[model samples]
Target: MSHSTNLSHHSRRIDLDAPLHRKAGPMTHAMQPVESAGEAQTSQACPTPRYLTNSEAAAFLRLSPRTLEKQRVIGGGPRFHKFGRRVMYAVTDLEAWAGERSFETTFDPEYIDRHPGVQRDDQ
Candidate 1:
């Protein structure tokens, strides 16, 4: 099969739990600004801090929020701070944490053989 077919097949199998929310198209005429009163009430609903929230941190790591909390208790996650009862993570620290976990592979001939079509490509 062609490379494009292979890429399309691979892309179709993607399964991500946390997907980014997006609008389908450009704004329509029906889109109206809410009144200031409604805006004030909406803003009051669970105030998220200027810093990264637990959900944001989890999204950054591509993990569930509970998993992040578990890592925090076990000292396995990036360093964070508590602002009162709420836990906050630094964007820079999370980036550093991701970088530290990155790994480089040392390809082996046997390993290549285990992957379909890889051996054919090699030789």
Candidate 2:
């Protein structure tokens, strides 16, 4: 129920009774980088849904976290799940919702009226 981490500029172990991706109080840990490129490739080959905190999901979607919170309240953000009191988003759901909002032009109905800041970048 604990994982290896280096917090407070010192090596320590942290309990993970909840999901590892969730922030522990004010302390949030980033995915630890591997020691070698081989490890990086290995990790990428075994893809996992990266669970994101609301703030992290907001950064990933180029929105303010407050916007996500509002979306949660009023409905219609990317699908998210609650781990008890914690709210977590899956990368897959975020990508799917972003894909759903993709539009070709700024004048597209959904683009202008509904999802103002989102557009399909065909790149």
Candidate 3:
């Protein structure tokens, strides 16, 4: 089976049968905005909520879903909400949680104060 792929910036088509690495130049394609009827209807019905699921929140923070689950069980996780038995994380809460952990260095005195459970190597 052969497939035709369009190259960006150049008016040339590459065949799938050819060696991809050799024929396919820079893999950069500009994305075009698309609007569908469903999207319009949904927007008109209600504004989208800035909430993410456990997996999505984990991905946004570059953490594993298991880690988030553990944090939820133990402590020190971002603020979450329960909407009809569904756990959701707000974008603002995630941002605030991440912001709180920011420090200039590991040995910063504030780090020890914020995380009292942590043990410093020096100590």
Candidate 4:
């Protein structure tokens, strides 16, 4: 991981070699890096973790945006922060929320409800 200065007089450290391409696609012609709107939206940082938007968080949780929104409104979902009009979910918070929903039985949706002192996997 190499950090270099941007093309200016200033020597501020910035990583430019990080791949922003989302995924590699099948080549129909000469192989070229296919850049899309999604790729453009992604950050190119290596060591730093970025926040997830509503869509990104929903995708990360494998749920629909509407479902995540509903959970947020009802106050039983991953913790989130609001920056002006934008809603953001931290990666750690999302992971913790998902971990809390885990159970030994897949059929029991009310397992957490029935069991009282069951701690999360973190314990």
Q: How high is the lDDT of residue 104 in model 3?
A: 99
lDDT of 2 by residue, 7-117 (tens): 778666766643554544433434332234575687689787779899988877879999999999999989999999999999889989999988888777877678545
Error of 3 at 102 (Å): 0.4
Candidates ranked by lDDT: 2, 3, 4, 1
Instruction: Give one digit per residue, the lDDT tens place, for model 3 in 63-86.
Output: 999999999999999999999988
Against the true structure, candidate 4 has what lDDT? Answer: 0.72
RMSD of 1: 18.8
- Tell me the lDDT of model 2 at 73: 98
- The lDDT for every candidate, in the order shown, is 0.66, 0.78, 0.77, 0.72
Query: Which 10 consecutive residues of model 4 have the lowest summed lDDT?
Result: 26-35
Q: What is the lDDT of residue 111 in candidate 1?
A: 48
Residue by residue across 1-123, what tens digits does model 1's lDDT show? Answer: 565434544555534422333333322223322234566687689565335788877776778999889989887788888989999997778878878665445266544544557766768
Residue 95 C-alpha lDDT in model 4:
84
State TM-scores per candidate: 0.46, 0.54, 0.58, 0.52
Off by over 4 Å in 3: 1-49, 115-120
Can you list the residue pairs that collide in candidate 1? none
For candidate 4, lDDT tens digit of each residue in 22-67? 3344222342334455754564534355588998788777789998
Give the residue spans of candidate 1 off by over 4 A: 1-50, 106-123
Per-candidate clashes come to: 0, 0, 0, 0
